[model samples]
Target: MLVHTAWNDLPGSVRRAVVARTGPVRSVTPAGAGATCRLAATLQTGSGVVFVKGILVGDRLAWTLRNEIRVNPHLPGIAPRLLWHVEQDGWLVAGFEHVAGRHADLRPGSADLSAVAAVLAGLAAAPRPGLPVRPFAARWSGLIDSWHVAGSTLAHTDMSRRNWLIGDGGARLVDWATPAVGPAWLDTAFTVVRLVRYGHSPADAEGWAGQIPAFSAASGESLTRFAGALADMWQRQQDRAPAAHRGLLVDAARAWCRYRSGRSAVLMSG
Candidate 1:
């Protein structure tokens, strides 16, 4: 379990690093939600408010904080701008331009769906960055067919509603800590599972995904393989270490696989 550190409790070296950039700190408010990070807060400075997230240097997931710093620059307007990053007193912290927006509501028929679609399309067009992160095929090697993993597109991978912000400009993706270079449609596929969690049936979630150009262009055979791969992956994760929400995700993934299986049957019959 992740333990949150109160802003006042941050080591002096870390606070000094933040103050160097933002000047005197007026207040600190916990901001955003995620299980991966030990600290996420908005610091009010004399200049302005900036969002900062960090983890202990010894934590295994500390590398993800560095990855977020490296990936945020490539995201452009699709994510909050990275102001700076600091490593001090056994902690790694990154500051970002604060975005005052609510978590996107992704239930069926919400206007946020279109914005989510637009964001996915934009991400599909982003240039691939030079990163050593594993490709989708290699990451899920045995779970998915090798043929479907041959694309250089950069994918955010994790598209939960908590990772999105519905701001004045539209939906913006956040927490790009687990980006991958893989099929352009992979992110869309991940979102389909999230849509299922948000009350959309598997069929409806797949329908929403199909509207995106990248996803629409992908072959049904590949999509079915991907769907089954995700189901298997989530089921294994749940079995090894049960999480309250992991079962829901596993159910959603299985539902998507069933939908694809039925579609494949129909196609074969025709």
Candidate 2:
């Protein structure tokens, strides 16, 4: 029962341009919505079904959308298929080939873990040309020193289980805008949190975290420092988000923190 947003009201020119390329849109289904002016809509077109991520116009909004479209294709099947993009109208609309799959949830299994792991693995590999890398390394390096010790090739900063879409074609990651140019552990840690929420054993989570340093080091960032940066990032997001959602994120972070702290105790005991 998602409601329409003012963003849903596309301008005549934008509508015509889309129809011209894609043909009349049969319907626009609300796929998902998130904070920060991001709305995912399923656009049914005569050619085929596509997903439109409408980002509000202005500010640095256009750059974020542009960054996503630029990097998503580099990841190929690992990410959604990009169709087209236009910055003219108030909203930046980028179309992707529809991917059919359920979001990752808290359920224990090898496949889910493996799928998530693969995504992180891919990120550790590296980013392609035409994408900026220093933004991540510089920020990560700064965080490491500021916090203490610390770090994706692919910047899937929002790699919660929910972001991974497992479909018949293959497992594809949605929400590409968050991609960055840093160590893979950053994304790995982010993804691990989601699995932990699904009730993954503390041992498993710790094991994953322990391995993060090596992965992140490939990008020249220390695990300890990167971790501090991540903590700060999470806090900033919680602070910036609306009050209602802030509590939710804070609770989630608190739970994960508790689990992580307990793991440290176990390691010390061992």
Clashing pairs in 1: none
Q: In angstroms, what RMSD does candidate 1 have relative to the true structure?
A: 1.6
User: Residue 57 of candidate 2: its Cα lDDT?
Assistant: 73
Number of the top-ranking candidate, with lDDT as the measure: 1
Candidate 2 has a TM-score of 0.76
The digit string of per-residue lDDT tens for model 2 on 193-212 reads 55555666545664664554
